[model samples]
Target chain A: MVDDNTLLERRNVVKKIVDHRGNAKIITGLGSPTYDVFDAGDSHSNFYLWGGMGGTAMIGLGLAMSIPDTPIIVITGDGEQLMGLGSLASIGVQKPNNLAIVVLDNGHFGETGMQKSHTSYGINLCKIAEASKFEFFFDVVSNNDLENLIEILPPVKGPIFANIRIKSQNPPRKLPILDGVELKNRFRKNLGVEPL
Target chain B: MKVDDIQNNWEEKLFSLLLDHKIDFLPYVPDAGHAKLIALAEKNKLLKPVVLTSEEEGVAFASGSWLGNKKSVLLMQSSGVGNCINMLSILSKCNFPFVTLITMRGEFGEFNSWQIPMGQATKKTLEAMGIIVHRATHPSDVCPLVDAALYGAFSSDQQIALLLSQRLIGKKKW
Candidate 1:
């Protein structure tokens, strides 16, 4: 379990990660991760899941498989990740080299009035990823660990899973475009595809 | 062709149709009825066959595939259709094109009481969720309906559910 004292602020960590992201398509999980990614700087390439709680990781897998040469990252919260934990096993089996999943472990369901989550009690997401056979697994707790993750995430040749311990603080909501069609078309246009 | 050979040919034909439409991502939950199609997808070097843990993930995977300008198709059984209701909302709301080939169970079957409820509800449930349901009860109808579903999904950006009836795939022998 991650010690609370060693946790980093979610926004700062997200910013650092996004800053280092070089031409990688990002899929953000619902709630905080979506806000965090938008806080970093909105891009046409960022596909925010405004409501799909458990489907984020597989979406990243699909994107990774579709565009094999490009990097794909899924940034989600612990609660959301737990809801779709089965995705880890599926991802492990496919073994997509261009995919990475980063979990912001605040140990609570921030979307639901700060209710305690499984990670807060004893659920170890990094261990779960390891057991699922992720090529790289990191339980990040400090600045140096975060830096190491940012360095290794983009170019990693296999599925990489990282659970970064984050402080539990409710930042003001930063909502992106809620219309799914518009979001899809913009993302497609960014990929140089004609919008349907 | 022999009787058994003809049955296998239909499955291969469906696979070829998907390939013709440029579906590079194949996400599926294992179903006996789809075994031949799944096997063909696995052996194809150009297609990325993903084994999904649940039926719902296939929806998201297909959505992501489309967002990246690639096409995908999901394969599951009738029972698995129940697991996809909530996720189907994402497809409808987002106007994302979804194509899933479902194998019917519990219909025209002599066993497995548990599969009956979902089997009966599959078509209505998909319809309620605003998906266009297409069923193929005979071997000859398989390729054409699948072709239409694929065209509707991609060209019109519609959610299409292609249900393969038990009569077409043959009843499981107990």
Candidate 2:
């Protein structure tokens, strides 16, 4: 196992991704992934999930399909992605060109007290994405792979999938509006959709 | 009309309701009861048919589709409802408009003993989670109830599940 200090810091990973997001909307998985996104930068385009544990990627797929002109990125955790592994296969069949999913895999369930997760025990999520028919799949273990991900995020041919390795260290939580309705309405409002 | 003709007629009318209202996104897990409608949706250019790996994914997909300002419906069997319990929390919490067409199993003369528990528990389970549950016991009741569900869901932001009872769907002969 790699040392926690030696692995890439999760905060910087998020900062780089959000810094280059351009006009893309983001959907974060529940828990630490939400914190990571908010820590990077907050925007009305960010749809943060407070409790939906496993639906992050499919939501990106849905958004990409409906709003074809806009790019969609799903930033989620290894635990959340593992819960929705079947979604990769589902998204693969559609292959929506506007959607990209980046799982910030720290190899531990960060939100659940740093328990060693399946990814920690030799499970390869990028392989699952590739096998599931994601045309652009990346295993970001180094800075070059990370740069490559940012380069292709715009004008991308998805379904694109990437698994980025992060250190198993907890950062102070930074929460956005935890109210689901407000977060949802704010997100839709920014997209020029009427509040429900 | 024969029994088969009446059943087909009801299915067609419900399918037409979705088309007429421009419900462009349909996410579904294939079921015997929804087979014909799924087939029709697959062929229609106006509808984007998304095949989900599980029923819960449909809940998330529907929310995202709505966020993008599109009408989305989920189609699943009574058994699949069990998979959606937790994911459906996003709908009620966010007040996201949601409509799902659920075909009942383990009802009437059902032979599959395994499906009985979830089928019987489906309505109460959904209702417990703040979802309005409506059941269509006869072929004639299906379209009207579904139309009402679609209206309440989108216009009023109500989360509703339309249960097409096994009695309406008829017994599956093995």
Candidate 3:
């Protein structure tokens, strides 16, 4: 079985994303501990976004549509993607030029439990994207591919899906600064809504 | 225009209304009853038609799109109201506008048993969640009610519905 905690691979991709500091907004559906890494590092002017399993891609698409020419990166889980694969077709239809949808295929819902996921079916996510006319897509299962993604991803202009196979490692149940409610409130405040 | 004229040709009118309201993003799940409206949306150049797999995702997408500063509308069937409950809570808690153009099912000669429970409860459920529920019983009433629903939901920043009854579909399958 492939290791789920491919830390080096995760680090490399995160670095490439953060190093740019352009219009890239990191969107994730993983729970607090996993998504906090992106929230803490993102330096964009506005951090209006959403979180939760099975909804990141759709959220990213919404953001990308609102701000044309702004690059948005969606970090999704294998289990999450399985729950919302229909997003692929919907996003493909929109065909936002500055969207990159990356899936961390750890073969399980790591936040809740390391339960076996539908990705175990060897479902070709690349093929699924291709079927939807999403051309710039790949599966990065190694350190080399992760590095290469940085160089290769920028020039490609369209909706791209990169599935990175990860080895599962237990993340802490709690985040350092924000709980789910706080995370949601921060996003709402960024959107100019007062506290509820 | 006569009511039949509007009912027989609601697609073009619907598209015009959405554009007039400056609604840029739309999330929907395909329903035969909503076929013409969906097709019109697909053909419209100014409006973006996004097809979601389920109604709940459509709600979440519409809410997110609103947060992103784009006006959005969710189009789905009446039974989909059930699927949207949790997301509605999120919208209500956040005090964000979420508008849905629900094609009414399992009411007024609804054949499907599966659609009954939710159909019976749709308005009550929306009311319970503090969402304004507006029904368009005839095609002639659709445009004004839809516009009103959008305004009510967006201006108040609350969840609301424009329930389009099956009669508007004009398909007598029963």
Root-mean-square deviation of each candidate, in angstroms? 2.3, 2.0, 4.1
**Among these predicted structures, which one has the highest TM-score?**
2
Candidate 2 ranges with C-alpha deviation above 4 Å:
A1-3, B1-8
Q: What share of the true interface contacts does candidate 3 keep?
A: 0.37
In order, the first chain's TM-score in every candidate is 0.97, 0.97, 0.77
Off by over 4 Å in 1: A1-5, B1-8
Task: Give the DockQ (C-alpha) for candidate 2.
Answer: 0.84
Per residue, candidate 1 scores C-alpha lDDT tens digits across B1-174 of 111233358988888898999888889998888888889988998776889889999998999888888889999999999998887888987899989999998797537888999999999999999999999989889899989988989998989998999878877776
Give candidate 1's error at residue A62 in angstroms. 0.2
Q: In candidate 1, what are the lDDT values of residues A1-196, reduced to their tens digit?
A: 5566667999999999898889899999999999999999999999999876799998998888889899999999999999899999989998889999999999999988999999888889999999999999889999999988988868458799999999999899999889889888888999898876
List each candidate's DockQ score: 0.77, 0.84, 0.42
Question: For model 2, what is the alpha-carbon lDDT of residue B124?
Answer: 88
lDDT of 2 by residue, B1-174 (tens): 112223357877888999987898889998878888888888888887899889999999999998898989999999999899899999989999999999999888888798899988999899988999999998888888988999999999999999988788777876
Candidate 3 at residue A130, lDDT? 84
* TM-score for candidate 1, residues paired by index: 0.96
For candidate 2 chain A, which ten residues in a row score worst on lDDT? Answer: A1-10
* lDDT (Cα, 0-100) at B64 in candidate 3: 60
Docking class of 2: high
